[model samples]
Target: MGKDTDIDLMLRFGQGDETAFRSLYMTYRKKIINYCYRFFFDLGTAEELSQEVFMRVYKAGSRYRPEAEFSTWLFKIATHLCLNELRKKRYKNWFVSLDSEEGSVANQLADPSPEILAVMEGRERKKKITSAIRALPGKQRAAVLLREYHGFSYKEIAFQLGQSESSVKALIFRGRDHLKQTLCGEFGEGL
Candidate 1:
């Protein structure tokens, strides 16, 4: 089963197959959540937003059209929700934790080993990358994430973003340039 199967399932759900909706939900639940997580860097918010996406899908079932792939449509909804949330909150700062279960403060204190230092360094790099991405203008961030992280083609991203393909290309190019400048400044190396 592939994209066509998704369309069939959506059409079936539209026609009142509860099981079809369930199947679609189960299939996309984690993907949507992770996508939202990347946008907000918060698992709880991501889960909540993903629920809203499915809710919209459920409510719009009857009107759902196969104008695009189901995943593309689903992501469009997710993107809008995420962008709206950003505007509503206007979070000025976000702190990403550098600790993991294995790298707890107590453990680090007990053994300030080279391996632990490496792990900490890796987390720092990730933090810098995440911060750089978050600093991008919303549309550019969305375009970059959709193209680089989500493996979306320019056409698909344009469709999801309601922009022209050339515009999507420009957004991604500018986004990448911004990220490169920011990350290179921090790391003193190419991204």
Candidate 2:
């Protein structure tokens, strides 16, 4: 069978086609899951949030408008949901853990060079950087994640976060400055 286009699938799904909705879910699940994973640093929570994101989409399918690209709308929804979760009292202290198993994997993937290992303590440096990112305030962290990690334009981030583009740029600048300070303190000026 031929693959249905995104707009076509979305239109069909809006008309109550379950199969089309499932197809849409299958298409974006990994991206949503990874996005959540990066913020929460917990696999189980990320998986749960991914399911919730799709559930929200399924419920709101009838209201889905095509004014912008489907991805823009989808990311707007995901960003709001993540912000809500971050605001919950239970997660007020949800900082990323440097000693977590996930951190170890990230460290391993970041600096795989044997020569680099010989020149520097790669794993320890990676952990410090990760911890510094986690130490940032939520807005700064979100701005950094969306722009640096997700490759969002400042305008796109402003749309997602309901801020002005200038504000988004400021947040990103502050976040990067904080990261730089933290990394430099831990790994010296060269890092």
Candidate 3:
């Protein structure tokens, strides 16, 4: 048998086809999960966020118009949810622990007895850059992630973010400037 097309699956699901919803869910689950992970830096939270994102998709399916590409629309939904999550965390003053998200800085620094101090300093500098990106305003962070991490065009990001193209560009530029200043501070003199 052949696979159903995206439009067909969406149409069927809109008409209350549970199987179509299941099919769509299975197809986009991983992408949504990874997208959320980019924001939350935790697999368990990302998984939960992905499920919620899919639930929103199912609820909004009937009202969805094909005016935009399904992939773009799906990402818009995911980005909005992740941005909202960040806002909530900000209001609560909660810090996202990126400790387990990557290799330990400790482990890298531990065996630094032989290697030049500059290489280990570079690793620390990278961490500062990552943290500075995280410290950006939610929209700015989203702008950076969409453009740099996901390779989205300015037009596409502005559309997804519901902002003017100029505004999106400004956000990315300001975000990058902030990261640069932050790294400069961390590495001293000529970063």
Candidate 4:
């Protein structure tokens, strides 16, 4: 457990040990869900995507290899699925509705008071950041998330992304630059 036995568990599962697969799934399920959630900012979609990742894991267990850390390989699968889903969404022009006919949660809950206004402003800033990240090209977004959010090393990210280390660096740099410009433009020089 100290040094990541996920590879061992995966190997055991590959040898037809069902409990190893269950243990592996139990260990990484939440991490996978949250990874997907951070990637797309949708709980439902994140859950769905994580399930698909595990499904792929289950199906491919027989052919699993230990070329990298299991987490890195697992995330590579998730990343590819995420990029493909983003491409599909882009083509479909999908949009998630923030409000229903009744009204948005913010509108219904707000009393137009001082404290509520501060909370609303914070939410707005977060929304802006999410929007900026969502606007990034799929690979750039994946690179940034793997490095910044998941604490992945440059080499690990490059391996997970199937890109050279230099390419991963450039993607992260460009992603950060775009976020800085978008957020700073909204927040002014103080940002």
Candidate 5:
């Protein structure tokens, strides 16, 4: 069979095509997992949450609306799910331990080759940037993640978050300011 388009694959999956569902799963799995990882800072939890997100998609297939872009819809779901998780964590007084075994700072700092080490250091710096992002209020974090990590335009993020584009911009601005304050000590004046 010829390769199916995303819309066609989604339609087939909605009609109970197992192979089509598998194809969709294979296509977006890594992206979703990475997105979740960036939010939670835990590879295993991200993997589990990614699977859960897909499960939700599978279950909602019959009601899936094509009015919005598929990716926008997918990210809306992911954003809500991650926000809910964060809220629960907050209510439970739980925090992502800095000492978690999954890709901690020490591991990131141990690169051998100088060039690779520099690249790794850059990644670590970005991780710190993201860590400051996580420390923002929920809406700010969501806005920053969607814009910086997913490259979503303000209008798209506003649509996904059901906010005005100006609101999205404000959230992003506040997020950036918070990150700048948190990172200024390390990055110096140019941050």
Candidate 6:
């Protein structure tokens, strides 16, 4: 009769309703997995982390509260895990893969276009943007990804990141400015 809300579903799960857990997992599984993928650009690790995220959610069952939205709580858990993993690599080596469909830069630039150089330049631009994003510090990158890629509001990002809205705004602002500088140079058009 009524559409099921995430809060309602979570509450049901907390009550030991297996169907509710299944529904909740199905609803957010792909989203959290993809979100995690953006961090490592690796499907296997992302899948592992996403599975852990759900495990944390399941463990938090009886303690779950609706103080924040379900998405927000879930992402908070995911962000914590991702940040922890990133911190471990802060000074260590990290590399990007070159899978054509999976974000490997070489694969991204490998395809030829009917327009030849023009299409190549367009892909180059995309590659440049990706490089700039990679250059961003993890928190700034996370802020930008949450706000831009995931359609999160500044307020939502702040809530998810445990920061003030002003802080989230500043992070996004700085991150965008860095990207603009990297892509746009002194003039409007990219060099």
All candidates' lDDT scores? 0.86, 0.76, 0.74, 0.83, 0.76, 0.78
- Kindly give the stretch of ten consecutive residues in candidate 6 with the minimal lDDT sum: 97-106
Q: Give the per-residue lDDT digits (tens) of candidate 2, residues 1-191.
A: 23337767888899989898888788888888877776666689888888888888888788877765566567777878877887887777756555656445546786567665543556666656768876777778778888777787888788888899999999999999998887786677975
lDDT accuracy of residue 144 in candidate 4: 91
Per-model TM-score on C-alpha atoms = 0.88, 0.76, 0.70, 0.85, 0.78, 0.79
Between which residue pairs do clashes occur in model 4? none
* Model 3: per-residue Cα lDDT over 137-178, one tens digit each: 788888888888777788888888999999999999998888
User: Which pairs of residues collide in candidate 3?
Assistant: none
Q: Write candidate 6's Cα lDDT for 22-115 as tens digits.
A: 8888888998998888776668888999999999999999888887778887888898887777788552366443222333443566675557
What lDDT would candidate 3 get against the real structure?
Answer: 0.74
For TM-score, candidate 2 versus 3, the one ahead is 2
Error of 1 at 56 (Å): 0.5
Query: For residue 67, what is the lDDT in candidate 3?
Result: 54
* Best candidate, TM-score: 1
Model 5 per-residue lDDT tens digits across residues 1-191: 23237667777888878898788788788878887787777788788888889999899886766756667777877888877887775524434333334346446665467776676667667766656656777778888888888888898888878899999999999888988898898689987
> How would the candidate models be sorted by TM-score, starting from the highest?
1, 4, 6, 5, 2, 3
For candidate 3, give the lDDT of residue 121.
Answer: 56
TM-score of 2: 0.76
Which whole-number lDDT from 0 to 100 does residue 19 have in model 5? 92
Full ranking by lDDT: 1, 4, 6, 5, 2, 3
Q: On a 0 to 1 TM-score scale, where does candidate 1 land against the true structure?
A: 0.88
Model 6 collision count:
1
Candidate 6's C-alpha lDDT? 0.78
In candidate 1, stretches whose alpha carbon ends up further than 4 angstroms from where it belongs are 92-111
Q: Choose 3 or 6, whichever is better by TM-score.
A: 6
